[model samples]
Target: EDGSAAWLRYAPLPHDSSHSSLPSSIITLNSTRGSPVYTAQQELRRGIQGIFGKTLNNGTSSNQHGAIIVGTAQAYQKSYGEFDDAKELEEDGYFLSSESNQVLIIGQNERGALYGSFDYLSRLAQGKLGAVSYVSNPHASIRWTNEWDNMDGSIERGYAGPSIFFENGFVTDNVTRVAEYARLLASIRINGMIVNNVNANATLLSPRNINGLGRLADAMRPYGVQLGISLNFASPQTFGGLSTFDPLDPAVDAWWANITNQIYARVPDMAGYLVKANSEGQPGPLTYNRTLAEGANMFARAAKPHGGIVMFRAFVYDNHINESNWKADRANAAVEFFQDLDGKFDDNVVVQIKYGPIDFQVREPVSPLFSTLRNTSTAIELQVTQEYLGQQTHLVYLAPLWKEILEFDMKADNRSSKVKDIISGERFRRPLGGSAGVVNVGTNTTWLGSHLSMSNLYAYGLLAWDPALGAEELLQDWIRLTFGHDKKVIETVTEMSMKSWPAYENYTGNLGIQTLTDILYTHFGPNPATMDNNGWGQWTRADKFSIGMDRTVKNGTGNAGQYPSEVAKVYESIETTPDNLLLWFHHVNYTHRLKSGKTVIQHFYDSHYEGAATAQDLVEQWNSLEGRIDVERFEHVLFRQKYQAGHALVWRDSINQFYYNLSEIKDEAGRVGNHPYRIEAEKMTLDGYRSYSVNPFHTASGAKAIV
Candidate 1:
């Protein structure tokens, strides 16, 4: 199954393991046939059989000595007595404990029991199957994964393989993989998944597609995973034969209501609709001169009747930014778009704001819109796909980045307000809030592009459930579950994953300039030369003397002014801006000194060299554990590690040479643009590079030296 089972591969525990007073029977309460309760009961049986080499009997009526009892709070209250702690649990919270050799996995609802079941199984896999007691509740109401999968079986911005939901422009009949995917998601407490690209097609709303969605829903129902869709806002005109898809138009409203009713009719437990409107040429209410709130409220109104939500994306920006105009900035788009319409949206509409103001940059300031939209529901959108952070080819653990975003203080209302509080509906006391991650999984055997990349998927769910969980700790849990509890394997994989994100950022983009990849291509290679004279709103603004966008309020785009007073002042001046994001806010000279007392150009050189060196060390670390895990996964990870090591050198040299060329400066270490195997400028044509005779940095090198 080549990594397809993911972290659910329940290999047997070590025969000589300590604390092996395992449960003798699996017990359940009020477990109706074909319900989530029954599914959980079956899962525990299957998992215990795989781990313990014994099939435990179902002892619901029998008072077995070492029985694992799993059920809802009501079921437990009916079977035993009322549990006082059961009242403490929220809607999806669970209570797990072991007292007097009896284990209890209880949920406020059936879904929580499933989560508790998985947690108990995870502990068993991690060799912690002993006495324990805890009440686990997710901080956020909605923990969702949005897949950017198209109906054509292609995944947009996807480095993994094709889509698992669709094939040849239609839903695949065999959904065995979908069931497995649901199991994987349920294990991580991921309740909902929007399975299509936000840039949607009209065909997704057709009768055939609706039936297919029902099939998918049926497949996922046992695991308690709800299905959602990304709607094409222009569906009224494109699919309903209406003239104008205006939110204010009664005909358009009727069309949406009809569609919503159809969707809910087919799949009773359909999650909701995710809308990306008036952004990047997607048809939106803006076309009809309607406000974004008006655009979103229509969908919300239609879904409200069915108890569904309308997740309106706040990624609205003019891709063709007037960059020649210095004051024009795309970073201000979301704040400007929804700041005034804060109270205008329906209660069921949640504004899904990206973690950063701009697109998913390697390093970026938290989005100001998060604090500004005080009256509307909001959800912090994160990308687990690694689109700008090495696209899963590079081993980048994203939990650290997400933790920073969730932990940032917004200073709303002249007081401290952390982002996690705001998104969890605690800060504003709003009706709804949560986190949404753009998942990178596909039909690839490894789930992601590589086995190591699965950490991002695992960590996203864990962090969404509890943002306070440390990235390193989450990685440890994932490592134990996926590869068993070998000390060497756990330590080695954790170190590599923990170091990966920082190494990737260091080599690709220092001082938060964002990765200098080619904007037109797949965004995979160094192309600093294309930063200027482009309208993607991602400008480096690198001229002969200085680099970076001057976004301070005084002399530039005034984007810093978007933040609250306390945060605004810090970013408004170069002295207070953090060194990591210095270049993101202010344009600086090549000779300008950072807080670390190094020149901007020198920092670039040193960071890239160090990062590349660290990437090679990752290969070494993985090589040291060659025999620690299964040969298949070990070899697969080794192949990726070797590729990443080689590619890191390419990232290092190309970025170093690009900046060196732009500034016409030599590295203080004499490493940049001074490689011993350098190719001359004349021999560094694109054709020569394509032919593998010249390095991408255009330095003199052997044909075989090119990655």
Candidate 2:
């Protein structure tokens, strides 16, 4: 009821449902107590007991007639016979067969067996008990979640609470929560996690902390989750008492090699290192006048001997931009930085590019870097923490948004170059590729601060494994497993979740203007002024008449040309660009007519009102299910819904008013600046509060003062 179990709740099925056909006994061919196969057996037993209310007998039975056999394909072959089905499985892949009285769960490896058990359990928990057989293989090899949890118990961009992995500048001594988190991740088929902030601390490389990481890894090892860490690029000089941390320097390379060896000594199956360097004040090879490839390869070489990969971030950009320059765009940074370095990286290094060229905006063209890095392994970076999309307070299902990016055809060499294919190492024909989700889960029992927000996390893992899955189908499965089989619950949650991304985009930022949030600090609420007039190149270019960033090759920053020729041609022209991203590709007058037949400013006004209205509707829909679900979860979600409804209004009014005051454009519907039902805060009788002028007054709906 507290939502600690998440989708793994395994709540009892309806009394009318039949359990007679379910397998009676569980058998594990590999009896290694601490292995993934053993974990699968334990999980199967737990799931069977919870769902059917019957504890099945464990151990190899002489009669395999009515038993579930779970093990690696090698083990199964040794026990029964060679499994032809194993050939179809890739790494961490499995086949689940319940075709007869006996159920066979075979995996390519021990981890695959564990994943198979979870998949089987998910189907059972969802009440899919009819005979079925299928081989499921992961779309990519590296499926990971990057936590931005700091060692001081604070999480950067994490909204839930303090860090569960660390406290007072060290990994936490107790890893009970870490193990629980690993279980939840394993259920969703997430194989790895980076437990520290990408803006890393050098102290994490300390001997004491390395030992602590071993403990954390041990706790998660049973669940088949490998551990990774974010490294501070200057760790050699800062933490190891070295003179230089230059990538080309032999001393620095030896320092990193030694430290990597030390880490592997403690945690043998370490997934890898994640590095965010030369961006936003982080130190990198750029500091030493070396290329990004050199920096990445240095770590890649160190981790290679231990079979670990280096996830070098492609979020590098100049923090300080001259706003007055029309051609300086941050959206061009990734391709500008990494395109020339295409075949230069070590095989074990994957360039982790954000889905967008900029930060995780509500809407962005799939980073052109996905197309440019053909010779280099690439993984799309997605944010599950909702840093820019209302930070989990609003129910924004990101699957649709991610699906759009994953399925977007970049037309690389005029071929079927989908983002998913490139990241899966299929189109590019690379060895290592996948996705890394920035899921800054904190201490909240709900895992992601809110109950509905967990759906995004659920869909993220499922999509990473298989990008072709429908967003709605994934949400429905999660709804059934987490909430229950209530038809209305499934229907209503789906409606709200499906509409959430668009609704959030409407109120916060429209027509690819980026989230008009306070970019300088807390990325919350509407602060259109903060978006412009700053060094950060996430600009709107709004003035007296025009709004948007002109990224066309002929006219502006040439960002539109970053895409492959075929894709670039579409974005390069205003007429060809989709209306949804019109602003991103061109700077237009407020009077410019959209493909929707509405003037630019008028569409802004209408969409804000429409989005806020939808937020209110979400509240009403949830209220309809008050009695259908538990009071604990119902009340918890209702509180967030109510807050979202109110905040959405602030977003709507502030954005509409800010643009109205700038462009002097009135809404065609006579809604902007006309709030007949509104009461001015300054008109109220003053108590402890006094009317004060709001600096950057557009943030307060163009109001002069507030009490």
Candidate 3:
């Protein structure tokens, strides 16, 4: 239950468990000193010891009792017979096969060898070894996570606490927790990491800081995780002391080339740069009248020769709001800006688009830019840090939400174009840069700081590996990995984790209005009133009659036109749109009857109350496991679940009351809708509700972001 260990909880395998008729012995062909392949050998030994109570003997010799042979393809190709062509395993590829007398694990490189070792262990853990004889891979070329931890010892959007990576304006000398994080990433097949904030400063690339990055790279290399940094587009001006950072300027280009080379020299496997440009006041090419592509191209050129790439962000938005007829839609920025230069970007400059168009709201239409650009290399970005999902306090398993977003068919052609296919580079076969998750793991014992939130991390990896996997299957995998093979633990967590998103959807923001967090500052807790004035796309368009953003070409903002013709018509007409995303796509009157037959306003009222009501059920179910599981994690999850059950009530009443007062609609059941409503104190109208006391933040301060 020490979440510090994350998923690396190498516990004793079940004594009654049985292995398939596959590899029982392991042959680790690792002679190269300090190589990732060697590390693989060590890990395999440890894994086999923990899972099967067998210290797998490492050797170059073949075996008869079904042996697992692991090594770089070159070392084993001659002994185990040629691999026909070993060239395809270029980017950390591995091959595994089961035989009557032995099993062979092949690798094109040491990293591949290590990856193969981990794959072997995972199959053993999942008890899926008897079924397949195939190679394992992460589908995305780049699988990474961004941490918004700063050197000042404070994490930007991190809810778990301060930070495990930094303190006192320097990287942490204690690398134990960070090392465990690398293992977790490795176990889940995450290959890259951005160790700092994307709203990055140039000081991070300075000599004092660069060495810190080098040390981090060293710590991660053993686990096959490469280190990437957030690059400042204004680095030439700030760090190199140049008067201008124009991409056309030779000095700017030269400075970046040198920095990239120096980083490569210090850490031969440095993963390259992540750039945030012209977004929310971050300086970029726009200052010099340059296109966003031009800015990203400069670094892409600099890093190309050194085997690096630049992850250019598509999160640009004008921070200052203009009330004029200009009507700048921040939600429309990524598609508007990037669509023009679709084919202009360098091969290495990936357009990292957020999952939703306007930041990581609870529910949003997939970014239209994802469908618009056919030629550019793109990656979908997701947030694992619960900034908008009640931080780590509320257990909102995001797999279901992600499955909805990833499985969305953009209909680029006659074939339904799901977001997963678009980003995975399979639908169009374009070179996909990779997928990144903004997952912050801070100083809390549960690396997410909360034990239950670990589901998000596990799900991110599985989705990154193969977007085709089901959320139900993933939920099971995470449960087994974290809580072990207990059926009750399985059933209990499955119930809670599976329904949490809807539970969250119910209590926080019904009908896709977003978790009504205080929009101006830290995006936490419920604040429904402040949502109206934010100039955000969540324009309810409600007076006394309706609430929703009208996005149709004929009657709305024409945002729906951004999708391809086949897909555009779905959202353009409210009748065809799914009820889950109805409020997000169209403006409706209070009496607007959803397919469910309830009026739009009434649907909101019903769901919020029902959603909060469900939380009590979650609490009751969790309490049943009080003495069944480890008390540490049990108590931790129990307290949080109970806490969330109460928080759900506050969410239900505030949101329900907000809408009820706005439309003057009475609850059909004669539920409590009175002014100064004690949504918590009076739960009698409904048999189910839990209200927790909270000293909620009162004001909204503009200019500060939620991180």
lDDT score of model 3? Answer: 0.78
**Candidate 2: which stretches are off by over 4 Å?**
59-61, 686-696, 701-707
lDDT tens string, model 2, 1-707? Answer: 98899999888886567666688898997888878899999999999899888888864657888899999998888888877788898899999999897999998999999999999999999999888899999999999999999999999999889999999999999899999999999988999999999999999988899999999999999989999999999999998899899999999999999999999999999999999999999999999999999999999999999999999999999999999887899999989999899999999999999999999999999998999997899998999999998988888999999999999999999998999999999998999999999999888999889999999999999899999999999999999999999999999999999999999999999899999998998888889989887887989999989999999999899998888899999999988999889998899999999998999999999999999999999999999999999999999999999999999998998999888888887888998888888877777887888787776575554365555
Q: Using TM-score as the measure, what is the rank order of every candidate, best first?
A: 2, 1, 3
TM-score of 1: 0.96
The sequence of per-residue lDDT tens digits that candidate 3 reaches over residues 198-287 is 878677776767788888888888888889988878889987889999998888889888888888888888887899998877899999
Best by TM-score: 2
Clashes of each: 5, 0, 5
Q: All candidates' TM-scores?
A: 0.96, 0.98, 0.92
**Best of the two (1, 3) by lDDT:** 1
Q: Between prediction 1 and prediction 2, which has the larger lDDT?
A: 2
Ten residues in sequence with the least summed lDDT for candidate 2:
698-707
Best by lDDT: 2
Q: lDDT order of candidates, best first?
A: 2, 1, 3
lDDT values for all models: 0.86, 0.92, 0.78
